[model samples]
Target: MSDQEASQTSGVIKKFLYVNRRAPHGSNYAQEGLEVALIGAAFEQDVAMAYIDDGVFQLKTDQDTSEIGTKNFSPTYRALGDYDVKKIYVERESLEKRGLTQDDLMPLVYEDEDDDWEEKPMINLVTAAELQDIIEQSDVVLNF
Candidate 1:
């Protein structure tokens, strides 16, 4: 059997890439995407999440949804690390067009056992081309 086929039969982890392309709270897509990511992570798969276009706004800090009659779920992103879902990639171009920087995003960090349990940033800044490469390497890609 081929390497990938053999790996699948051996129950090796599969790489799952979730692409988020919508503005958070404008509709249900962003929230649904996050839900899907959480579900996939729960399966113990290798999950990688990419935020592109308006989806980059989902990580913006200090989001207040109370005025819109919605519960602010932005903080949930911070909890993703607890679920072991930490490979978050934000497209640099998308952030630039939105006039956002890494500082504008919520500080998502995880406890690193390899680093003596020190916390490290979960979000990764990536170029559009790099995101594309990631998509290509994934076993499955879910676009939102």
Candidate 2:
């Protein structure tokens, strides 16, 4: 293999997990984090995103970006699929606290549930245990 092939190989990770624990549009943290996820996805990285606590706010409905005086990047969440990085998972308890159900979330908020709605329900929430599994399955982890 050439040096270029070796460099590309070195950049790949088995899995890359990012834990987003902040609200969208509060600062640039959430925005930058999502950028990282998208970049990883574009690079063909096995990227996964987890919403913990306030991170659920990122999936909130009908954002008022005009008042915030910034471009609304909220809709970009749905575009992750274009980059093949839609392995989105949320915490069950966080949903309950936010009074939000999977159905309540917007179209962008993707939960990795089976497509067969009849054969399997579409709740893609993971308990704290499963969150641990997410971490364990990841070869590289980022906390944002």
Candidate 3:
């Protein structure tokens, strides 16, 4: 078996790249998606969560989750650091037209500010080329 396959079976480390592409609380799946990410982290797997396209909504600032009366698990995202799985990245263009600046998302994530703003979520954004590299590097990928 390949090292990655062997590792996965041996329970050594399974590197997963989680692709989140929905708004938080917009649907029940988004919340459940976060749960899966955390569960993977707890298993001591190397997990990285990526917010692409509309998935950026999952990391919006000042998310007043009380109306839902559901636990705001967004805060728990920070706790992923404790699991040593803290590579959270949001798409640059995704942050722009949403009227969200980098600092606007600080508490939620460490996003980069030096990029295009006031653009469509898909315009002038990181090319799929970049994402391909990330996908190739990960042992497995889960989409939400």
Candidate 4:
């Protein structure tokens, strides 16, 4: 069904939070979580994603998986905005512990349809405390 049709049949719009705590490679948790988040967004749900622990590595730029024989799915993250999946949260402590900064991540942005199609960022670098509040506010939390 289309997003509008799904929304109409679902009644209440739920806030879905997909939490990622795994690295981008090695396993499928990160990729599977991303697919689920996009699916939720396609259903017209309020979907957001949080990256903690090694999950922060999923967004880090300049990733090369050639040696591992794994496809680099990092570029797919850039399409989250197209699915209307904004509100991506990255834990501050995770970045610090990894010695990485926002500059090391891909620049993900979305066009605000209600604001004359103005482009805006989707990534929100938040602290552990703020992330906790976000988790509490979510109606559904899926971890990977």
Candidate 5:
């Protein structure tokens, strides 16, 4: 069935969690996961994304794929807010282990429509335990 049909029939907004554990460029997992999340959001699902392990690097800024002969898809992340997929959780442990900080990541933000469209940060630095809780709360979990 189509997304609109499914939504009209069920009228249920499910919480979808897309978990990323792979590096962004080496394979297709990260990119595919991102595409799926955007599609889910477009379907009016409550979409959230989690970055863990090497996946945290996906959010890092200033990615240059020119030398590698790969298209730089990192900029697409900034568009998540437009899709209403604003809950982007970055695992603290993952960043620490890689000697990275939140500052190293892209500055993603969203406008709060209910609050006079106030711009707010979208990337949330979360503990492993907190991320687990979020995972538990999700209705569907997609792993990459």
Candidate 6:
């Protein structure tokens, strides 16, 4: 095989969407969702995460899980970049209904190697309609 042919190949790349509608720390859903997302990224699939309802709290800054005797894993979302899972869609209405703005959330960013390590925001504040479209376009939709 030619060197170029050896370097280039195509495989089944599935689009995975993880829908998080539950509050973090209330149950294992958010944490487990993140775990699944990381696993999907490790498989080199196209993965996107959607935070709706109370799930928006998952990405909120200043979470004090210590009060409840559980370790806060909010920081793990930031590491999604290392795994190439960049798309994190936060439902705008969910945030507003919860009295949260984009500034209330953690700034999740990833270094784009192709862009000379330029930092890019991973959290996408999307509308309900937009989020619906995202879900419709995904090949595999996993709701938690």
* Candidate lDDT (C-alpha), each: 0.87, 0.76, 0.66, 0.91, 0.91, 0.88
TM-scores, each model vs. reference: 0.89, 0.80, 0.71, 0.93, 0.94, 0.90
Model 5, runs deviating above 4 Å: 1-10
Instruction: For model 5, name the residue pairs that clash.
Output: none
- List, residue by residue over 1-144, the lDDT tens digit for candidate 5: 376665674667889999999999989898888888776665778888999999999999999999999888999999999889878999999999999999999999988898998889999999999999999999999899
Those runs of model 1 whose alpha carbons end farther than 4 Å from true positions after fitting are 1-10
Q: List runs of model 2 lying over 4 Å from the truth.
A: 1-7, 10-13, 109-123
lDDT of 6 by residue, 1-144 (tens): 344542353366889999999998979989988898876664667888899999999998988887799879988988988889888999999999999999999998889989999999999999999999999999999998
Top candidate, metric TM-score: 5
Candidate that scores best on lDDT: 4
Model 4 scores a TM of 0.93
Model 1 Cα lDDT, one tens digit per residue, 21-95? 998987988888888887555467788889999999999999988889976888889888887887999999999
Q: Which stretch of 10 consecutive residues in model 4 shows the poorest summed lDDT?
A: 1-10
RMSD of each: 5.1, 4.8, 8.5, 1.7, 1.5, 4.8
Model 5 TM-score, all chains together: 0.94
lDDT of 6: 0.88
Candidate 3, pairs of clashing residues = none
Q: What ranges in model 3 sit over 4 Å off? A: 1-11, 108-128
* lDDT by residue for model 2 (1-67), tens: 3556546777656788889899887788899998888766545667788898889888777877998
Model 3 deviation from native, Cα RMSD in Å: 8.5
Query: Which window of 10 residues has the lowest lDDT sum in candidate 2?
Result: 115-124
